[model samples]
Target: MSPYLLIQLAALGLYLFLVAVNWSALPEPMAVHFDASGDPNGFMSQAWGAVGIPLMVWAMFFGLTVLGRDPGFFARMKRFSPSGWRAWAEFNTLMGLGLLTVSSMTVLYNVEAIPGEWIGYSVWIFLAFAFLAIYRLASVGR
Candidate 1:
């Protein structure tokens, strides 16, 4: 596996580990949504709140990996630039990690393990990663 793929797997593993380790301690109704100021404004079933986000994150990256394997998936991009699948992997890894960070923070926040305000910080971090991913994607095939 490329280092980028490994990093993506690591992110998936970390997200799962966090959810599993904290599952029992989480409230039945978790505070899953927060406002601009980081206060919880919405709630959900603990199972879904804890598991849904991470699963979605992993699934999205996994889909990207699968798409990369399709015969014609990278052909067009490869024609324009040789980086090909590696570039996709890099983008996938970053977006996955950024999402994982935010998801993990929300899970932790629900347990009162983290301050309410840190969710915003995690969101900011995700946005930074997102912008970097955009630049990387746009630069591909250049």
Candidate 2:
């Protein structure tokens, strides 16, 4: 496997490990059962977890496949010379920053629901996508 694939797998493993370690501490339900549903942040946190976890997995696996097929991915990224790059950067920034913030805040607010185990998985997934977004955004080499 390529070094990049190794890194991706390792990250995935590490995240799973953390989630297992903290499983017992996390909240039982992982959601607002009653009136708490009105809490926007709380709702957002749950939404992030539901959406972010899958997104992270998709991005890492997809990105790995993409980069693997084109080992010169970095070169290609750096070669971008178009106004579209700005739009790409903005899109990624919005996605990465938005998801990262929501995920982080969810972990913070729902400490019970987000024990070390869940937190690890949720966060690592968020980070994976966030990393991809950041990389893509930052790759515009003028």
Candidate 3:
């Protein structure tokens, strides 16, 4: 399996685990309220987790597995093409940036809806910076 895919699977599993943990902590009334409202707060919290933790893990693995390795390391290790990786990078970068912008605006507009709006803002800003750093690195190479 591709490292990226593995990272995603691990992320999803972790996300589910987090939800399970958090869900268990809530009272029945709040849980029902969350379900009724589609749990926007929970959704945002999970999203932040899914994006933040797993991406860091994947970056570490990518650095170790791909960087300073053999020239055809990716080609031999995975079936994904360079073009496909490029597309994936672009898509994720845009999504990361979008999430950052949206989360910031959400914090600014509805600070009472969710806890830790300041943390969310900071996390989103980090994600935005990470994406921009990756984009800049990619562009310099190209």
lDDT of 2 at 141: 63
Sorted by lDDT, highest first, which candidate order results? 1, 2, 3
The number of residue pairs in model 1 that clash at the backbone is 0
lDDT of each: 0.79, 0.46, 0.44
Instruction: List, residue by residue over 19-65, the lDDT tens digit for candidate 2.
Output: 45554554544542213232423233333353447357446554644
Q: What would the TM-scores of all predictions be?
A: 0.87, 0.39, 0.38
Report the C-alpha lDDT of model 3 over 36-67, residue by residue, as the tens digit.
22233443343344345445544554444334
Most accurate candidate by lDDT: 1
- Kindly list the per-residue Cα lDDT of model 1 for residues 1-142, writing each as its tens digit: 5676677778778888988898888898988889999989989898778887667766788678667756677675545344656666777877778877888998899777999789988898789888887787787766
Best by TM-score: 1
Number of colliding residue pairs in each model = 0, 4, 0
**Rank list by TM-score:** 1, 2, 3
Clashes of 3: 0
